[model samples]
Structures are given as structure tokens and as C-alpha cells.
Target: MKAASKKTAGTIALNDRREICNVPEPSTTRLNKRMAELGMCSRREADDWIARGWVRVDGQVAPMGLQVAADARIDVDPKARGQQQEQVTILLNKPIGYVSGQAEDGYQPAVVLVEERNHWRGDASKTRFAPQQLRGLAPAGRLDIDSIGLLVLTQDGRIARQLIGEDSGMEKEYLVRVTYGDVAADVQSAFPRAQLMRLRHGLSLDNQPLKPAQVDWQNPEQLRFVLTEGKKRQIRRMCEQVGLKVVGLKRIRIGRVLLGNLPVGQWRYLAPQERF
Candidate 1:
């Protein structure tokens, strides 16, 4: 006797003649793309390999723009990974007069901060300056060419984002040495005893009381200024308005990072775990 038919499960099957696989498709993607997803080679390099017929999929030569299953046999030519692993980060106590990124008339790029002669034997080979690395490397933040202080240059993107981001909230501290002409005691009395002065009355005060400055006697004529923000020639400008002249300006710290005892014109590799 013939058996009775079962009720339909109500699922419609796709009926396309071009469909090749009975397997419900492994989320179709390209071989070159798959290689890139595996962190093997860049997508552009992967495409070039495919064009050269060097890329294989399940043992068949693949073409540029060919589509393949997400999981496919993939291999990259030996040089595709290139020399990116040797990326480095250098921290320099930048001296006056070196532009941070690109060289301009009469001045050198801060990158020269590490001339070949300065490269220690253990540092990466001359290939350290390879073009691919330079594309991602830059000074994470700036120190004006006229100023002297700790400047950071790095190949890492995360640190750069942190240092220059608007909400970075990093405190940069400076020690400014200033000298003042003899001012009548009345003028001095009108201003707070802070190393920075606020024009309290009948005065032009533009800055916000100069960031809550601290005053201390360095000598009868000289005062030491410590500040958190490095506005343009701010110490010099402030001193000029108060009958004083800035003789020296030096940055001592950025966030918890310090200038330490590092000598002028020298640099050190940032410790691998160091940030901010």
C-alpha cells in the first residue's frame, strides 16, 4: 500500500540555474579579501598577487576581483608583509629650532633627531627609515620650534590620538625663568603674589588669571614660573606686561611623563609599556 504524503513545512527553496553549490554557501567573499582578513597581506597587495596569477584558490589560479568562499586556500608572496614589525617610538628632549614633521627652509626636520650616527648598534638596521613606516610615523604632539622640551615621535597611532585629541586633558608643565625691572611697590601690591599676576582693577586681563600660578623667590630680580599650558610665547608675553622679561623657558613634563635627566640633543626609546 502507498504511504500518505506528509504536510508541507512551508519553506520555499531557491531555484536559480547558475547556483553551483548545494552547500548553503559559506557567506561568499573573495580569496584576496580572505587573505587580508587573516592579516596575511593588504587588500591592494592581495589584488596584485591575483593579477600576477600567483594567488590560488583550492589549487586553481585566481584572477583579480574573483569571488571565492570566505574560507579558501590562500597564501601571499614572501615580501607582502614587508618591514612593518620593526616600528619604533623615540622620545627626544627636543632642542630649540627643529620643526617636528617636515623640513623647511634653513631648518631640519625633527626626524633628523636620529641621524645615522646616533643609531646604536642594537637598533633596527638602516631600513628603519623605510618609506612604508614613515607613512604612519609622526610626532605625536608638537613643541614649537623655538621652545625646548620633551617631544615624542612614534610609529603607533593610538598614542598620537591620545596626545593630540581635544579632550586629552594632559597637563604640560613648564619652568620659565624671568627677570623684572624694579616696579613701584604699589603696582606689585595690586596683583596677587602669584608668580603670574592677574590684573584685578583698572587693568587688561585676558587670560584666566594665568592658570592659578605659583610664586616663589628665586632671587630679588628673577622669578621662576611654573605653568600647565604652553600658550604661544605666553610666559614672555605675561612677563612683558608685568614689567619683566622671560630669559629662559623649558618644559618639564607632559601628563605624568617627565623630562627626567635626559641630556639635551639626545633621545631614548620609549619603554614598550609606557603610555601618556
Candidate 2:
């Protein structure tokens, strides 16, 4: 038997079937949050577009703090909604040639080193750098192009903030090889069995002043230095000022984290319990 169509007060077209329905009172959810729930874009992106007057809800412009019914007509401008959502974090044992962030005149940024094959899948091997995890990942800290060491790229802002924030207590350790112009006899005597050296009163020819440093011999030619703050070309400059020319400089650790045997140009995860 064919059903009779009642007087249509309102209509909802679902799966190509037109059905008569009552028009319930309109309800609302915060526009920015609603946009994010739809997975269309980030909440911040929605807020920016709404302020630019580009988002429309129920066929009208959306204003900040304005709410709209969940089922209301909503449209994001063509140019507004960006590309597919993919967040990635790539830990790279950055080699000497690549810059840390933006491109320089001829050098490529390190982020490009992450290849599709490295994209992290749930599998152990694939989780190294996942395609889906690439969305908002960025370099949390920096490594000089001339320096080879551990570099971290991450989507976690809290981790990034903790590691590189100005007030961060994280320590960066380096292995430096130095060649001195004229070795001070006292320094050579102090250097041999010394686990620590203080350059306070200052090293002078009569007595040259050197900044205090915690230095330890890694080998006859190398010294390990641990510092909490990083300044531009700090180690190199410090070595030069002390009458020692730095022939090689490598960052071997950051906080309790070691660059380890990851190999040059390779990277791995800091174990779950690892914290800076």
C-alpha cells in the first residue's frame, strides 16, 4: 500500500530519500570548535577565517563567538580549508650540510630529509617518521649546519617548549678537539689528570683570563664539555679565545639524551621514560 504524504512542515533529505519532519528549534555549538570536530581544519584556522568573514553558517556570515545548529548549512570558503591532515615528527641525525630550518642560498633544510618510506606506520620500522604524523611537526631546537648531531622534529608543543624554552634546565654536551697556539705549562699539568677545570682568576701569559668550564678528557686529544646554555658558535669561540683552535666540534648529548650510535644522518626515538 502506498503511504499518503502528510502536509510538509519541513523536509530532511537523507540518503536520497525525502522525508517530512518537524522543524525543531535551532541549537548551537561554538563555530570554531564545531569546525575542528568536523576535522575540516584546526580551531585556530577556523577562528582566523571567521574573523576575515569568510565562513558561512546557515547561509550567513559567521562572527566570532557565534554559534550554529549542528545540522545547519555550513560552508567553508574554497581557499580557506587547507590540504589533507597529516602530522609527522622526524628525528634526524642531521649531518654537516643541511640547515636546521628554512632554506639558505644553496643548502636544503633538514626536514626534507624525511622521506615517504620513513613515514611512521604502527609497525616499529615505519613509526620512524609517519606521514599521518606530519601535520604540525616542526623543529623544536637547532643544530648548526657545520655541526653533526641529534636534531628533533616533533608535533608535541609541550615537549618542544620544555626542551628549548629559555628557562629550560636541559644541558647540551659536546666533544671538542683543540689545538693550542702555545700550551701553558700549568694548563698542560692541570689538564692531564683533571676531571674539572675552573678558568675564573683567568689564564694569563703572565696570566690570561679564561671563563670557567667543566672540562674532562675523553681522549688525549678531545675534551667533553657540558653546558646548560648555547650561544652562537660558543665552543668554537671559547676555544679560540683560549689560544686553542677548534679542529672539530660535535654535540654528543642534550640533557640526559645521547646521540648514541644512531649513525651519521640517522635518528631514533627517545625512550618513553626519557625526559630532558
| Cα lDDT tens digits for candidate 2, 1-276 | 123232232233331253235445557789987876665555666787788888999889988988877897778776663322233334567888898888997999887776654333322333344555656667877778888777888755445656776566677787876655555333444342322333222332224334455567677567777765556666676655545666677877777767776666665554555566
lDDT of 1 at 203: 21
Q: TM-score for each prediction?
A: 0.52, 0.56
Q: Candidate 1 regions off by >4 Å?
A: 1-86, 119-135, 182-230
Candidate 2 weakest lDDT stretch, 10 residues: 1-10
Best by TM-score: 2
Lowest summed lDDT over 10 consecutive residues: which window, candidate 1? 1-10
Alpha-carbon deviation at 256 in model 1, angstroms: 1.8
